[model samples]
Target: MKSGDKVLETAGILVPKVCILGVTITLINKTTEYS
Candidate 1:
C-alpha cells in the first residue's frame, strides 16, 4: 500500500512536471520565432 501510494504521488508530480515542461517548450519556441 505504501509503495502504491508513493507511485501515485510520483505520478502526480510527474504529470505537472510534464505539463510545465510542455508549456516551457512552447514558450521557448514562440520566443525564438518572435526574436
Candidate 2:
C-alpha cells in the first residue's frame, strides 16, 4: 500500500522531467537548424 503511494509519487515527478527533456531537445534542434 505505502509502496504503491511511493511509486505514484515518483512517477509524478518523472513525468514532468521527461516532458522538459523532450521540449529542451526540440528547442536545441530548432536552434541548430536556424544558426
Per-model CA lDDT versus the true structure: 0.97, 0.98
For residues 1-35, write the lDDT of model 2, one tens digit per residue. Answer: 69999999999999999999999999999999999
Residue 33 of model 2: what lDDT?
100
Candidate 2 Cα outliers beyond 4 Å, as residue runs: none
How much is 11 displaced in model 2, in angstroms? 0.5
Global CA lDDT computed for model 1: 0.97
Tens digits of per-residue lDDT for model 1 on 2-29?
A: 9999999999999999999999999999
- Global Cα lDDT for candidate 2: 0.98
For residue 2, model 2's alpha carbon misses the true position, in angstroms, by 1.9
Worst 10 residues of 1 by lDDT: 1-10
Best by lDDT: 2
